[model samples]
Target: MPLDPFLADKVHLLDGLDWPQVQNDPQAAARLGEYLRDPGEWTAPDVSVEDRTVPGPHGRIPIRIYTPATEPGRALLWLHGGGFQGGDLDMPEAHQVSAELSARASALVVSVDYRRAVDGTHYPVPVDDAHAVWRWLGETLRLRSGPSGPVALGGASAGAAIALSTAIRLRDLGQRRPDALLLAYPFAHFPNPALDADTRVEMEALPPLLRFTTEGIESMVRNYVGRLSDLPPSAMPGAADLRGLPATGIVLAQYDDLRPSGELLERQLGEVGVGVRSYLAAGMTHGHLNRGPSLKEVDRSLDFLAAVLADGAAAPAEHPTYNG
Candidate 1:
């Protein structure tokens, strides 16, 4: 399928934009935000939201907690994506997704505002923050002992890498793992898997701003891990030992360059005997979750994630794939 007509019509909003420049310039960043902002006039469902900080490796980690009006069904800790350098709790990917999941799944959602890979910051910092929050939640919520409902860990793009890395860290440390994992258009590999011929041709029609060029991905990786040589498997985790990780739910954008990475991860997980559910958001681009739930694909993707959390880590008898 081609780009969704809704997004294709708005492609002009990102004309002449550069991501690195957008990162450094507030005006440029605002323009990119405007282009990614949801155009629908829908409002977020009612959910009690609280802003709080917890101790982290470096300092306090800010997080937003969302609680539904009804009884909580599951507990989720979600992180937003910005190539590990941008994004915050206010973004639709973080705010709207958390709000919707809280209401739709009746889950208690905690959205982390981890430190970005800026200035001299590097890998392990963001992962450390996420791990700290997970430990804190474990202590407060009694996740290890007899507790309330199932708990899930999830994220989008670079944040998904961090979530997986955190899961790996927990496994290595002999800590209790999350009941389930949710990843949305995850960038799990440094040198991403090559796109198929059909996908390559399909991506050629995308605007430059919507494309993740080789140079751009390399730059993002270098910024996050400092030097690209001797890269840590935990930072990317595409080639890491994934055995014993929780059942995973992945959402891939049909038109995304990073889709191959998510697909590869699904295969890798299945090979390692982990239950996996993969969903392709047809006609959507990367970070579609960043758009408001008013978009049909975005809403469906969120629903899939909610269902995963609701189901926990139980391995399905067979892998299930969804095309939204």
Candidate 2:
């Protein structure tokens, strides 16, 4: 499939633009925003939402909690993507996704406002924040016990990287792991796997602003970890020992440069005997979840995630892997 018609119609907005410049130029940024904007009218779902902070190593970590009107079947800690230096709990990827998942799966959703890899902040800060919240939620909500239902740790793009690192930390500490892991278009590997010929050709048709160039990926890694040399395996778990990790659900955007990373993660998890469920969002670019559920593909992606959460919650020990 090609790019979503909704996005294809606006690719002209990103003509001849690069991502780095968009950050400094208001007009360039606005045009990129226009290209990615959702045109549909969206209404917030009926879920109880609250903003609160939890104690962390650096300081208090901010988080948004959403509870469904009905009894929640499970709990999820979700992080939104923005490379590694951007994004917040207010983004639709964090806000709307949490709200909709809370209602759709009848699950308690907590969206973390973890520190970004900027302003002298680097590796372990963001991962530490996510781990702190996971521990807090486990203690306060009794997530480890079955009485409170299953618990999952999930995120999109860079957020997904943080979530996976936190999970690895828990595994190393011998702490109770999350019942499941939900990742969306994850940036799990440094020097991400090469794109196939077909994907490379398709990506060539996309605007530079819409694609993750090698330079951009390298910059993101450098910013997050300072120096790429002697990088921690847990920081990019694609190369780490993933044997003890919990069952995982990965959502890959069909037209994304990072899709290879997510696919590699799926194979890695399976090779380690970890059950995995992966969904490919056809005709979609990276970070589609950030657009909210207004687009059909976005809605379908959310539905797939909700179903994965529900399935994991219902049978934590019986998750089936799709290696092919």
Candidate 3:
């Protein structure tokens, strides 16, 4: 499969700047805060986007809500990616996709401020924050206009992984899980260096549009989880039982090292009769989806997501606004 030309160009374009430069980026931190502090130009005029906080074990868990013009309160949850270490709800890369989801899916998007790994081990911090938010939304949020319709969940990279864990946890507790799941190059599983050769090769290419590398993935896992045993289905949801889960949309990057895991995740869920579908983005890499307007494949993914959220597995959307 050939790569989308729009994304191919951005790889070269972004290469001009060093990834390491943004490795522990101060600018990245700033971008994460921009959506909360200013909220300017981050949303469309037809939609309402705002920041709201919910009570968490840690104190106040902040979430940014983006609602389409039609509904005051539709249900949706979006998580951002940053290796479980750093990411803000306001980062342009993070908010852009949420904004796109709001406009295209016609649902409200809530991006959470789950704690990062800057201080300790994986579960209790990031996962705890996510779990707290999940429980609160289901038990306390006081959702209006009837039962929560299409409580879809989605995220990118690490956020995708967290989203995976959150869904698994919700289902395990016999709580209502997201009506559907969308995971883009989800950081679902560790390399498992133990996989057979055939499996290893397949896992090597993620969505490709997202620009993931075995090396890059290794770094994120090492920085966040530390070791294989330390990881959890609460963290690596793919490692957990996916049976009886919600309808799922798994988006894989063509060039990402985590591709096979995402595929494996889809297979596992499907085996459990958990209606599932996957989109193999031709010629894209890890991190490509975050580029937003810079890549058409990203737009396609957003539209595909919107269509699914609004219409279910009816058909692939040709554009962002398609309601059919």
lDDT of each: 0.88, 0.87, 0.66
Residue pairs with colliding backbones in model 2 are none
Residue range 1-324, candidate 1, lDDT tens digits:
788888888787777778677879888788777777676865878899999999998999999999898978678999999999999999888998899988988888999999999999999999999999998987878744523888899999999999999999999999978989999999999799999998899888777888999988999999999988899998889979999999899989999999999999999999999988778888899989878777888887887888788885342334343542
lDDT of 2 by residue, 187-292 (tens): 9998889999988997998877778888888999999998777889988878778988988888899999999999999889988888887878888999899886
Two-way lDDT contest, 2 vs 3, winner = 2
- Number of colliding residue pairs in model 3: 22
- lDDT comparing candidate 3 with the true structure: 0.66
* Minimal lDDT window, size 10, model 2: 313-322
Clash numbers, per candidate:
0, 0, 22
The order by descending TM-score is 2, 1, 3
Against the hidden reference, what TM-scores do the models get? 0.92, 0.93, 0.79
- Model 2 local distance difference test score: 0.87
Across residues 1-324, which tens digit of lDDT does each residue of candidate 3 receive? 445554333333333234554456777444333312321233343667788888877788888877777763346677888778877987654688778777777677777878777766556567667777776666644554423566677788888888888787777788777778777877777763234475346544323323455666677776677655556655667778777777777777666666777777777777888877777666666655555544556666676777667655443645433322
Error of 2 at 146 (Å): 10
Better of 1 and 2 by lDDT: 1
